[model samples]
Target: MAARSGRRRAIRGWLGKACTVIAAAVLVSSVGAAAAPAAPIHAPVLRAPAGGYEELWVPSSMGPIKIQVQWAARGGGAALYVLDGLRAPNDHSQWTSDTDALRQFANDNVTLVFPVGGRSSFYTDWYRSSSTNRQPITYKWETFLTRELPDFLAGYGVSRTNKAIVGASMGGNAALVLAAHHRDQFRFAGSFSGFVNPTFPMWNQAMRAAMWDEGQFNVDDMWGPAGDPAWSRNDATAQAERLRGLPMYVSSGNGMPGPPDLPYGAVNTVNAMALEAMTMTAAQIFRDRVAALGIGARIEIGNGTHTWPYWRQGLANARPMILDALGAH
Candidate 1:
């Protein structure tokens, strides 16, 4: 009987040891599961279709400004900022609407950026809101383009410093003004049928008339008055010396009907001709001023008019120089 009790005690001890071992194993597994690392979360990519453009709402002090962006074909970091004219629409840039800009740069290794909506604002930071039209927001495009937009673009692999700017008509002068002041941002600047010299005689009146006709925006709201220093500050010709080291392309038509102008009706063609003539005069003044300052710019004067086709051709002509300046393939 004593031998039997001893065997039972021995079995009970073995059972206790087995249960402890199993409990320890289960605890280790629970601790291991709790210590495992989790999967990481990633930010959404800011990209477009394979060969198309995407609309990105970039934040700015002026509000959330919408910009149309086409990523580089070969994954380049350089960008080309295409500015719109005085009659710029709020929906999209005229560059995308009127010209074959997308197809032209589809295979190129440079990101294309088109800033939308700044009709008759001259793409400049206005001194005050327009009193005539009671504009809701004070225009602050200069700050948005130079500072806010660049900072936002840096996160998307686009170089803030390596860039080019081009514009037709109103945007043309604004491009030069931006390049002249912010040399660190733009490597190249181009003006196609742009009114580069706003301080020229009778030009301010022309601008005033054009602004009123387009958007009822008073010119006084833009630069304060006709004799304000802001006029000279914004004038590309007045700031010619500032553009000394920058590569520039300036082109204008002689107000004559070119091959591109043949498709339009008589009134439209005549209007384009008149506008081109005036813009050409301003462009020439800017060119002469730059020349006097010993600044070399590719100045092309040919037969065309202030129309999309001519500006499209101008962009095509400036493509090689622009690509070279930006170090794009």
Candidate 2:
């Protein structure tokens, strides 16, 4: 009997140890659960003075998109979206850096909206991930610009419908595409030194080289193979009929240096000359297509290169048209 009692006490001792271990495990789990970090909360931070140049962090599916904005001088509702070239920087826009865009539009009674960062993206939605390199997320720029951005801007008294878009180089093509597709959003569209005819023979090759040079991005990842319908869809020349009744401005250089290239070195000037020549040819083709469709657009071809001075002048020339289209003084 005493032995039986001893065995029972031994089993109790084992049960007590097991319970203690289980209790310690539960305590540790509870402590760990309490110690876990919480999910981060994101909020938009505004920088710069009121009614002047301001930076806004807008939320999107890809991530937060930085938008540099110059508010209308007299509280006007009209806004102008200025897009950057192929090698757009992440922190700020080239428009603000290269030109006096902020001061030029400070009293224009039109808000200037510059979307920062889109290197080699062409500001379009991609078919898949970047083939040449790994991207953190699939680019959904079309949706962001057309839907998310406009929705956000509407809250700050900027009209979603009354807006103008202008771009230089790669951005110029994207502006035309966006205006052609979303006519209701834009009343005026301008392209300065853009390869508007992307589907042309050897044009895809040129684009592939440029994209690769800028960010090692694969052109195939943008809209699939060269013959894909997306290529034709994004081509401004191919979609010229859609731009009917829309006031538009198109300009390119004649491969020769004008006053702007005088300050640049020989190599820079030569490169600009070659690029401008190619873009001019494509712009001419696009102009012919628009004319054939009875679409009246302001086309300017002059002696200059693919440098920023000409583009800055182009913007200045188009400012009056933009204000008139948006009725923004």
Candidate 3:
């Protein structure tokens, strides 16, 4: 009877200690909860551009992206989306910086939407599980450009559904892909010196090299392996059928020095020549494929290299066609 009484007392003492520990844990949790700080604000900010353009930071899954827009002269019923080249700067659009795009379109009755940044992203969605060659952030640009940005711009009197898309180089490639995939949103598409047929032999290697130069992004993370189906799926030549009946303009240079070429001894001109040569080959393949598909498109080949001057010329050449398609006065 004495042993049983001792055992009962020990059990009761252990239960008392367990309760004390539980109470201590509860107290700590309550204190910590009370001391927790409030979450930080992440609202999008808008700033007016010095050149009369309005800039807005659009919130997306990939965080807030900056968009520079020149509101329409006649006020908001149509829009033209002008995309950047391979080396897209984070500050402003090349259209505004390199050329007189804004001043030229100042009187045009269409909002010129320019998405800034995205150096080597090609403005498409990425599947990045590894960070060896690319960043770990999510790239849902296809969603941002097609849906999120349009939906947000609607509140600002911009017509969400009525729009035309144009791009140069990398942006050119993405513009066609986006237009082909989402035909309902874009009525006209233009590509100037863009590498359109990326699935061609040795093209993926070139792309990888360019990406490494720009941001060290992985080609595989972009759409998957070179042999992956996405390579062909993203190729505009492969999807030429979808672009049928869509008003399109395709332009590229022969990489030879012309009016817009830099001085003969300039190394940048030599580099431009080499780059545009590759672009011409790919663009020709795409143009031929589209022609074979019975898609009537305006294709222009000029004696120029891959420079901002040539791109500006191409945009000026395609402007009337784009405005006509959008019925913009």
Candidate 4:
């Protein structure tokens, strides 16, 4: 584990430099430091929220990755993946700071994995590059959490199976993508105030209008650039057809454009003003596509914006669903 820490630190040291890429300049101006931090990130806490530990995960290909985990020490087993929204922080995210959701969920003895690093990788494995095209972002996360993280958890006496994946915004998409690709490991998936669409035109269709801001990063760069086949493969909503028994949770709010239904509140409002409308609309349409799926899932249009408070509020609807799934264990 110490070795893992060393490797993760090394990766972040390099990533801190590459965070100034052209795509970041275009994709999000407010997220300037999302890609800047090295691990051991600080959360502006009035006080520590409960108890948790931080660990570094190292994959053969990705080198080292920082993952902060929280869990109840005494109870049955469950694994939950908490993804960082765009502009992620290392120690804690809106996922923990914005609400009491973690208190409710962790009380049930679920293991929470928070992956912190908000580069262009989008938490996916790059198709042609193993850190080739992008030097700092090797994009080897697919293996680190999926293969090595779980093994590391077992060492800590954590649950190895009955995993549930969940997150908001980009993290939500990542949770879905991870679970969809590894159904054998992830029995349940959820996205709160999630960006649910991968193919903007094919599904939400609104993103094309709202997504061009900052430096104008084409979503394809995060997936595979335009005309690339990998885009088809990673489309989150498209993966729905392949999710036979896997249950899903997805939602989008009003902060995106005109509606004003951001789940979190202040943060969402700030983001709305700070971000380009194209980005918000893109996320909204993605959620709409999830609702369109009409699968054995839950998708809602809420009253708030995309702030942590709103997402925390949405959890009232989302929590039971996730717990019910985890209870299956």
Best-performing candidate as measured by TM-score:
1
- Cα-based lDDT for every prediction: 0.75, 0.74, 0.70, 0.51
Better of 3 and 4 by TM-score: 3
Candidate 3 runs further than 4 Å off = 1-51, 133-136, 263-265
**lDDT (10s digit) by residue, model 3, range 47-79:** 233235766778788888887777677664688
User: Over the stretch 1-329, how does candidate 2's per-residue lDDT look in tens digits?
Assistant: 00011111100000121112110000000000011212222322222344346667888988999887877777777899999877676766767766666666766778889898887788899988787877777788888889999988877778889999999888888999999999999999999988799898767776776666555688899998889999999999999998999999999989888666665566556666767777799889998898888999999999887767788889988989999999988
TM-score per prediction, in order, is: 0.85, 0.84, 0.83, 0.68
Q: How far is candidate 2 from the true structure (C-alpha RMSD, Å)?
A: 21.9
RMSD of 1: 27.3
Model 2: lDDT to the true structure: 0.74
Candidate 3: clashing residue pairs, number: 0
Best by lDDT: 1
| Per-residue lDDT over 1-329 for candidate 4, one digit per residue giving the tens place of the 0 to 100 score | 00011111100110111222211110111110112222322221111235433344534466556665565434345677777554454444445444555565544556666666644345667654422333444456667658877776665555567788877655667777888888778878877655555555432222221222222333444455544666655667667665656777666565343332232234334444332232245455655555576555655664444445445566656667777787732
Which rank order by TM-score, best down to worst?
Answer: 1, 2, 3, 4
lDDT of 1: 0.75
In model 2, the Cα lDDT at residue 229 comes to: 98
Q: Which stretches of candidate 1 lie over 4 Å from their true place?
A: 1-46
Give stretches of model 4 more than 4 Å off.
1-60, 90-94, 128-134, 202-221, 256-294
lDDT of 1 by residue, 69-152 (tens): 777887778999999877666766767756678778877889888887887888888999889998998899999899988888
